[model samples]
Target: MNEQQRVMQIFQAYREVNQAFFQVMAKVAQKHGLTPLQLIVLRILKEFPDIKLMELSDKLNLGNSTTSGIVDRMVKAGIITRERTESDRRAMTLKLSDKGTTLWEESNDMRLMLLRPLLGLSEEDQQQFHRIQTEILTILKTIKGDVLHD
Candidate 1:
C-alpha cells in the first residue's frame, strides 16, 4: 500500500480499537456508578497525590471552568478534596479522598484483569509490540503538542 493509505489504515484501526476499549471501560464505570470523566479524574488524582487544579485542567484538556465544576462535584461526592497549597495559600491542589482511592483501586484491578492475559505473548512479539507502540505514542505526542500547545 502507498504511504498515505497505510497511515490512514493505521489511524482508522487505532481509532476503532480505542473506541472499543473505551466502550468496555464505560460499561465498567457505569457498573461502579461513575462516569468515564469522573473515573479519569479519580485515576489522575491517585497518580498525582497533590495536583494543582490548573495543571489538571491542562493535562486533561479541559477548560478551567469545566475543571472547577468537575472538581466541585467530586468534592461534594467525597471522591476528592481541594485545598490550598501549604506553601502557597493562594494556589489550590487536589487529592483523592478515601472513597476516591477505593474506586481507583477497583478500576485498576479490573484493568489489570483484562490486560494480564493479553500480555502473555511470546517474548519477541512482546518486545516488538512494545517498541512499535512506544514509537507510535511518541509520534502522537508530537502531533498533539503541535495542535494543542498554547
Candidate 2:
C-alpha cells in the first residue's frame, strides 16, 4: 500500500481499539449503576474534593447547565453532596458522599480489566508501547490547533 493508505489504515485500527475500550468501560460502569460520565465525575471528585460547579464543568469540558444536571442527578442518587462554600456562600462546591467513595473504590476492578491486555505484553514491549503513545499524544497536541482549522 501507499504511504497515505498505510497511515489511514493505522488510524482506523487506533479508532477501533479506542471504541472497543470505551465500550467495555461503559458496560462496566453500567454494571455499577453509573454512566461513563458519572464514573468520571466520581473520579474527579475523589481527586479534587469539594470542587466548585464551574470548575468541575471546566474539567469535564461541558457546559455549566449540563454539568449542573449531572451533579443534580448524582446528588439525588445520594452519591454526591452539594453545599455552599464558606468563603463564597453564593457559589456551591461538590463532594463525593461516603457511598460514592466506596463505589469509586469498587470500580478499581475496571481499571485492572482495562490494563489486562497491556499487562500481558512483555516488559520491553509495554515500555515501547508507552513511549510511542506518549510521543503520539505530544505530536497531536502540538498540531491540534492547526489541524482544527481545516
Candidate 3:
C-alpha cells in the first residue's frame, strides 16, 4: 500500500480501538448508574481535587455552560460537591463527594479491562507501541495549529 493508504488504515484501526474502549467504558459506567462522561469527571476530580468549574471545563475540553450543566446534575445527584473558595467567595471549587469517591474506586477495574487487550502484545511490542503513540502525540501537538483545522 502507498503512504496515503497506510495512513488511512492506521486511522481506521485507531478509531476501531477507540470505539471498543468507549463501548467497554460505557457498559461499566451504566453498571454504576453513571454516564461515560460522568465517570470521566469522577476520575478527573479524583486527580485534581477542589478544581474550579472553568479549569474542569478546560480539562474536559467543553464549554462553561455545558460543564455547568454536567456539574449541576452531579451536584444534584450528590456525586459532587461545590463549595465557595475561602480566598475568593465568588469562585467555587468542585470535589467528589464520599459517594463519588466510592464510585471512582469501584470503577478502577475499568482500567484493567481496557488494558487486557494490550496485555496480549509482547513486551517489546508494547514498548514500540508506546513509543509510536508518544511520537504521534508530539508531532500532532507541534503541527496542531498549522496543519490541523478545528
Candidate 2 Cα misplacement greater than 4 A, ranges: 148-150
lDDT of each: 0.88, 0.90, 0.92
lDDT of 3 by residue, 1-150 (tens): 999999899889889989988988888889899999999999999999999999999999999999999999999999999999999999999999999999988886765776688788999998999999999788878888667665
Candidate 1 residue 30 Cα shift, in angstroms, is 1.3
Note the residue pairs that clash in candidate 2.
Answer: none
Which run of 10 residues does model 3 get worst, by summed lDDT? 107-116
The CA lDDT at 49 in model 3 is: 99
Q: Runs in model 1 with CA error above 4 Å?
A: 140-150
| TM, every model | 0.84, 0.89, 0.92
C-alpha positional error of residue 22 in candidate 3 after TM-score superposition, expressed in Å: 0.8
- TM-score, predicted candidate 3 vs. hidden true structure: 0.92
Of 1 and 3, which scores higher on lDDT?
A: 3
Can you give the lDDT of residue 108 in candidate 1?
Answer: 73
Worst 10 residues of 1 by lDDT: 111-120
Superposed by TM-score, candidate 3 places the C-alpha of residue 133 at a distance from the truth, in angstroms, of: 0.7
Better of 1 and 2 by lDDT: 2
